[model samples]
Target: MKALSSYLTPVRACGAWLLMTLTGGGAACAQAPQEATQDRMVAKVNGAPILVSDLKQVTDAQTQGIRYQFADDPTKLANEMAAVKLNALDTLIDCQLLADEFYKIGGVMKPEFLEQDLTQIIQMGFRGDREAFMADLAQNGLALEKFRELRERILIMNVMRARIAGTVEVTEESLQEHYEKNLRRWSGPGKVKLHTVTISKKTADARSVADSLHTKLADGGDFEEIARKSSADSHATRGGEWNWLDPTDLTGTVSEVVLATKQGEISEVIEQLDAFIIVRVDDRQEGDPKPFESVKNEVTKSLMDEVSKGRIAERMIHLRAAADIQRMGAD
Candidate 1:
């Protein structure tokens, strides 16, 4: 008999051997409920009933935007369903307890806040068409009024976050350490120094205008003077001077061509967002790790995120302990 490979060997085999150890019996002892109850009491938070219907509604709402496929194996499907129900119940209990704690600490949900949030959500869904957005919400088992109420609950959670997990501070020393450790990842592929003149489509004779500006440049005319007179960019008044920007800062095909060019080279016409841009590279900076001072703010923000996670975890622990919760169903 061949010895099993270390990688191929099972950590814990899910057969009679495993079952006997886990439950002190074999497959016969491991049996599921014959019928799934529709109105099962899953959990209770501070005397509040969390029914199967409630869990299903919350799970359905959460998964509405996600795509799911049931497992081909019946046993696997059953196991997954059990897991989902347990997770949903746990989530509901935590949410309800946290919400109660939030309410106790002078957190009040305002109707005006809900109205603003729901209006934004609906507008985002249907691109500012309120009636079409409301119709979509109705299709998803959400009434405008009910959605507003839910939005208020969400707003209250946000308030809890602000009160419990406040602003995080990151020091310069930490930023320097992070920058040194991840130097290669943060450095860009390349950099460019570009002078630009942009003209919008709304302006009359766009091509002719570009040609006229190009002729002036070719005849040794001042780029700044021409940019001030002919460019339509808001910065045109300041002689079309844009602060040195990374290629990634620009969108679309223009970025591609700009990053590829050598020093002091002019690019052909590049169109973007109903406007044409003429670019000339003043210089190029090869890919190199930026100085720590240059990216200190970015590093600070990253550190703040890590701090926020720990703060939120501690706050949640306190909130859960303080809440008066009762479970209606067995764990």
Candidate 2:
């Protein structure tokens, strides 16, 4: 794994496992076992066989989620499970394809690298309990060496991604285009810009004071001026001004008052356990569209991911086209 060390960073969790799934290697296991044997070849990629048992290992967790989601409706679970098995097989096939490519290029994974990763997996994934880790592998019908092989294949795919991502750069035009095309995703939640005036209820005449302040505010008094002289909230120094905030951030009845208040209008005194508060709605924004300049860095990263995924998807298509991919049973 000298090349692996050179190209790939330390592998954590793989979050891009399905970057090349559309290339094929799918079969519907929602029906029946392809054969009475558990080792039936569900797919063959470049003359290499991927077994049904291997497919099941990949589908196990996914099906677990689906099973829980549709527990009350067995029919829906079965229907979704059929597609899950198919997609899981595709993902496995893609992994195998990448592994095959790695070896074809004379890439070799070192045994020491495998041992290091296995040690780390034991430490991180199983709290250094090697016995528990071994038990888990055994229960899953995975031998120690086979599990390492799986990990090594994953490392190879990650290295491939690292290489691809490194080679690709985000262009300014592409970044802007991606952001504009996906405006809804880039848009922000509804938010309000607000200022407040607070009167401490601890004062014996707090309600009377709050009422007089509200009357003054209603008689064209400047809310900020009145707040600066009389308010008790944390923002009093800045005339009770607050940064643009999500309405939900206000919490409970406070949010309700803020939402119902019209922009530039002073709200009625809102009574609280320890304070009497009045809010002025400076501004309100719905589905706020953030400027591109404000979110350029985030958009750039998203664009790069899209670019990397596109390239990997293209690679998968080419690999499938050049290889002998046989889908066993119904796909």
What ranges in model 1 sit over 4 Å off?
Answer: 1-40, 68-87, 177-297, 327-331
lDDT tens digits by residue: candidate 1, 110-129:
44644555555555545677
Output the TM-score of candidate 2. Answer: 0.54
CA lDDT of every candidate: 0.58, 0.69
Error of 1 at 132 (Å): 1.8
lDDT of candidate 2 at residue 200, scale 0 to 100: 92
Best by TM-score: 2
Clashes of each: 0, 1
Question: Given candidate 1, what's the lDDT at residue 197?
Answer: 85
lDDT of 2 by residue, 175-270 (tens): 889998988667755889998999997877999999999999989988788878999988998988999999877745577778778888888877
